[model samples]
Target: MLINLWYVAEWSKTVKDKPVKAKVLGQNLVLFRDLEGNVKCTADVCLHRGGSLSNGWVNKKRDCVVCPYHGWEYNGEGKCTKIPSEGDDFKVPPRFKVDAYPVEERYGMIWVFMGDLDEKDRYPIPPLPEYDDPNFRGLETEFTWQAEASRVVENGIDIAHASFVHPVFGYPDTAEDNYIESIEKHEEWAVSHNVMYPPQLKGGFLGWRKLIRKDKQPTVVHPGWYLNGMTVKIQIDLRKDWKIVMFDANTPVDEHTTRTFAWQFRSFMKSPLFDKGSLKRLSTILHEDAQIVEASQPYYLPETLANEVSVKSDKFMSTFRMARRRCIEELGWQIDLDKRDSYNGKKVLTIPSPGRKEALAEGRGWVFETMPLVAPVKTPTEKKDFEKQVDELTVDQLNSKDNVIG
Candidate 1:
């Protein structure tokens, strides 16, 4: 069940008339934009003796990609347009075609579908709340590292690791007990949440100064396909001045290696803090995460093992893992527990979006619809009873097979 969906390959603006090579779901692809302004993605390997299409050049006039080897040309639809050695009257072999994936451009990123053509539109890339918001300012950066894609994604959701792994950006003392606030499912996308954090600083010199204050706002976590890679979106609201920070990350290249494209968005783009100093600070913070993430790679663990005791504030990690597992399973890629443990398996699929219904229909049903709403079950009596029951349960019971698991 290789569910087909779009994946963000690169910033739409990044691909010009020049060809760019990318990999999606383990397949090498060549992308380019023609004079007609349409973006095209095709197998980088030409069917004609397996030559690399990326090694060729783009013919803007004919809106085609020309293979460097022997001068074979392919149109945007991947149809053979010309063969240098053959006359125009010569019939082209059907096998002469190159593989083409469906592509869509949005939020400055070019998205390509890696699954079945019939289901292309069934799963749309997750929407970016900050993309069109005038109040938000966006900054982009690229990071190349020797690490698996799963490790990077897990790091993004692991709030606890932030304290030690990222001393500067991670505020352990101010860490809030985040719970899965809610999950919203759409025809093309899904969204989940961790506990909300207040804007007021609870610790640190900044906290003492009270320079920046925000309401207790929930952190939105969204993981889906964009371009030719996987993307994770985290949104936090700084209530005052309509300030917001949205972290948009994508893995254009995934293997034992990964390339991440990230952007920080805020309403105030002109402030000096955000201009030069803030950008540097943000880079440092990302670098911190990258270092730890890369280091943590060799010792990656499964989400099932991450179910150890969690404080009230540790709710986000659990909720995020559940949502991630759901997304992965929906995409028809199984979670190989053994491989995940070994750190050398397909831990995630390449589809930009997973068809919610199709994914849920495979097994466990859609938790979003079947799972009881627990956010509102916070009455004093209920809370006490729930905590008491969990406390009273034996270690075995707490870790029992019957317990609900992701």
Candidate 2:
């Protein structure tokens, strides 16, 4: 998993009066709301005796989370405020703190920056204009997939799969008619517009749903991906004034697990009575996707496309891969999974936070070691060579054999 990106740790409603446990990018985290009702996140491990802060409780003042094992009170900023054993007169050292992350509550989710980058350098969170728009009624749900996050994200943006997987989306006979209309790319995100001839909507009260769209109707779809939160957004224009938008934030619970926080919004269905069918259809789509993604070979996404064959239809997904790979190799944001796994049970390693970065700059030491990152390309010549290699890889992808079997 890549570091230095914003990730949805939990639903905002989930973290309230008590500390809640969350895991992202393989590291455990503790989330709680302070006295001011602001959400705060920090490494779950306490410096004293390796106790779990999440297993503890918010103190009486509601300003700090008190460790159950030793009564060490850590405030919202992760500074140790009180040590019961040390008595009132004792002052905790400046180094007595845990890694505290920057937290923002948006779109009903708790977004935490899982790296040490300062505020100015971090990419802004993905936008969801439909969240507060009155024209749309949104339903929120979450799903957990037993697969790597990158694989799950690719599946979400792959428009071609709807023909074979989701019956409500398209039909195999009309698959040839589906084509990408245009693609707009950015440094951290991209959006692709596609036109598809799909079958009619399946479910509705009685036979009224047939009026929405007939069989083989031309549909317009916009699929987008954002690096922040590992998000995927698909907007379907059912008609001029009718639309359905799905925004999903895929969080890497670990190397092999992904948790998706999803929101489905429909412009036509503004009443609560229609929500049941909308949610049921969304659930069906997710299950269909999980069946294929979980069973795919090569558990993690390939670092290169050498082992995979990609046709023109997969170019959008390739953009995501290329951007992620840049972060891994050029920016050195990828965690060294092998090194981390080696110290699995014996050592405690935390993702570096803004607090950790500040402490280190001042020559203060941390109790736990920081997670290891893959080495980045360091020299100017090496960067030029890497870019040339990427260009070659992209060129090689265009020569894919259509008849090749998976």
Candidate 3:
């Protein structure tokens, strides 16, 4: 896994005046908001006694983090500002400091770099689509589950598992052949996987309903990584108003745990009743997927030894692993030499394209230059007109048809 790149630590709203602990790619970090309202990430270990800084409280007056065990206070720059037992005239040791990482806030999330400060800007966070659209309503949710970071990510790109492990949560009824259209790599910082979800059995009650209405849809899954690690961004585009959902899973805890953040963007609804009902339905579906992911045992595996055979649907996963290996090598991260040799035996694996050099150079500050900003289709004019009427409709009229009762 690539280190020193920014990974989403928590939703921006969740980090307030309190301190929280986040682990990025196996590095434990203490995150807190200073009195000035700036977020910071520092090595969780106290310099004096190795006590976890996360166990301490934020001192608003001096804008420092006060270690609970020894009264050692550390500022945002990781320098010790106060040592309670020492006399005012006593000089603090020059080495009395904790390591700090660069942090930034965007898209309602806090992203932290987990490596040397000199390499901070080399890898950037990937840009998101929802940030620019006002009509898009964003709903964010988090899930804490026991799983390895790689396994959790592989699950996100595994289109075939939907029919089996997540059949009820709007996964297509049948597994259809899919292929990797293209893969964009960013050195050790990130990889963008573009997968085409071909027309298949649109399962789920919602699918049946759409079928009754003579609507058919195709989906594309765009998964990306940021901050040189396994944090995953999954964007799904369904053709209707309530069709798109974006999921960002940050493995900020460790190899055995993950903090999954999901965001749903629904186009303006014509009816408040429909909006509320849609939220509930989507939330339930997400929870179902969570349950399955949480239940998988031994979530992390050496990909070289995976018993599963690859098919057309697995192209993205296979390509992702190849890109990940190249990144690990490029960043000089440690690798199991045996596994490297084994993977080399298979000719199907290949390194990421060199074209990624330009994109990776743009890094974290890359702006979106493409359009169809919202889905290409505009809402029906009649539907927009009906929005006000539906808003004013009686409860009886709204509840006359129950989309959830099924």
- lDDT of model 2 at residue 234? 97
- Each candidate's TM vs. the true structure? 0.70, 0.94, 0.68
lDDT of candidate 2 over 1-406, digit per residue (tens): 9999999999999998999999999999999998899999999989999899999999999988889899999998899999999999999998899999999999999999999999999999999999999999999999999999999989999999999999898888888899888777666788889999888776677877888998888889999999999999999998898999999999999998899999999999699999998899899999999999999989998877567677778878877876787787668999999999999899999999999999989899887899999998632224333323222234344544421111
Pairs that collide, model 2: none
Q: Highest TM-score, which number?
A: 2
Best by lDDT: 2
Q: Candidate 3 on 15-57: residue-level lDDT in tens?
A: 7877787766555678899877899877776777667788899
The stretch of ten residues in a row with the least summed lDDT in candidate 1 is 369-378
Q: After superposing candidate 2 on the true structure, give the runs of residues whose Cα lies further than 4 Å from its correct spot.
A: 378-406
Question: Number of clashing residue pairs in every model?
Answer: 15, 0, 4
Model 1 TM-score is: 0.70
Error of 2 at 292 (Å): 0.1
**Deviation in Å, model 2, residue 174 alpha carbon:** 1.8
lDDT per residue for candidate 1 within 149-185, as digits (tens), equals 6566656655556446654434556564434454443
- Residue runs of model 1 more than 4 Å from their true location after superposition: 1-3, 169-210, 214-229, 269-273, 297-315, 323-331, 334-404
Instruction: Give me the runs in candidate 3 sitting further than 4 Å from their true place.
Output: 117-121, 168-174, 177-216, 220-229, 240-243, 268-298, 305-308, 334-406
Q: What RMSD does each model have against the real structure?
A: 10.1, 3.5, 16.4
CA lDDT, candidate 3, residue 47? 71
